[model samples]
Target: MTPPSRPKLSLRASLFGRFSLADTGHDLRPLPQQPKGPISMVMRLGAMGVLLGRTTRLVFSARTDKGDTLRLAHKFANGSAVFIVVAMSFVGMIMVYQSTVQLNRAVGDTQLVGAAFLKLLVRVLGPTVIGMLIACRIGAGIAAEIAAMAVTDQLDALRLCAADPIEVLMVPRLRAGIIAALSLVIIGSCASALAGMTTGVVLFSMSPSTFWNFELIDNADLVQGIAKAFVYGVTVPIVAGAVGLSARGGAAGVGRATTDAVVGCSFAIVVLDSLISLMSHVVAGL
Candidate 1:
């Protein structure tokens, strides 16, 4: 049996869509039109802009709830622990193996393998690769969570209660994102470096002494890697929250917002990585 087709207009929507009757009983009324395509896109973008601006303000505001933020941070940390460990371990191994193979093929000696891999992994790949993974998983969750809240009028109720959703919701996610991103990158970077060094020792016949001499990571690299982690941490949840809060169209809207959160956060992480690398180079040169 075919499922009944859902009415285009709810009782409320039908009431809202009603117009004055024409003289003829046979007069046909057109369906109420929803905003289509580009207009909807533009409106969504504008809404995201406003939401992000508010979220950023909330992140730095003294009035935002600290206890709630901390609670959220703790929750995300505990929840994501296994995922972080497994994902980073595999990513680290892959990064090391891939970099080693490419460099060794080109240089023959593979002596610079550790140095090259460390340079790229610490400053760029660590946060970004990890962030892309988070954007797909955690980011989508954040978006859906907020979007569900918005669709259910929970966000509206919060506003009516004189509570700021930005503080209670987005700020905590931002904190969680930073904590998660940084933790993952550090764990992943160490794992990757170890994998690279081990590969150099076992596969490339590189002596442990020589591998150590190549200098897997330096103080500057450590600092830069942490900075990248912080940046990615800040980026993902804010984007997710913005998309989520702006969502319309109920579950379908939440789904779109979730998808956008994934794609937007991934793209943002890659773009930010490039920008940060360039800025770091400029600063280092100066």
Candidate 2:
């Protein structure tokens, strides 16, 4: 096959004296069109949905390779744990102080402080706080790495080697994400509970056993927190992966994808937590 010609342009070589601008008369190649506003947002959301479905399907497929899964899981877990622990501990302290102040005003007893702190950590803080942490910590990294691979054509090379990108990349990340998120949630829950307990014991002058003695944590709290973790774990990878996979324009695009992934995952965690929490309440009632 032959190639198409660059349409020839014949133009005056002078504006004042030998001044010509970009060959002066040739029509410029059309610039790439960008999707605008609502359309662009909808397209991105649609792409994310598609990738979620595709990755979910790939997750169900049997595989012989466990090395990637295990390695990534360990890597993500180690990277995220310290930050989560520290953050949760601080969060726990603040909650304890605030809850103590409020409850002491109302009940005039520091004993009720433990009950409020326990409920706050188990019901809300454990999942939402951990989810946001993972978004900033892991989600951004995944998006950047995948975007770099896409820009450098490594994804193409993977396909050339007959590897399915979803199986090799997406599925492993999905597994690692869920495992790491769940682990972090458990650790965070403990850190928060311990903080609340310590603060109650020291500042509020409550007994240590008071912390766990309260019936603050019901079965719904446990179930909802776990569900939020799973939802967050699943959401982070899907949003990051889809944005990374679709990245264009080299370094700039990679940066954009990472930013998008972080923002999207954070927003997703909040929305999912709220919706699921409400849904769980409705379901429990029925």
The candidate maximizing TM-score is 2
Distance from true location, Cα of 60 in model 2, Å: 2.9
**Model 2 per-residue lDDT tens digits across residues 73-104:** 88888988999999999999898888788877
> Cα lDDT of model 1 overall?
0.70
What are the per-residue Cα lDDT tens digits for candidate 1 across 2-97? Answer: 997754543222221221011112212334564668865564455455555656676777376677667766766666666765676666567666
Clashing pairs in 2: none
Evaluated with lDDT, which candidate comes out highest?
2
Which window of ten consecutive residues has the lowest lDDT sum in model 1?
Answer: 15-24
RMSD of 1: 10.2
Q: Cα deviation of 17 in candidate 2 (Å)? A: 45
Error of 2 at 179 (Å): 0.6
TM-score of 2: 0.85
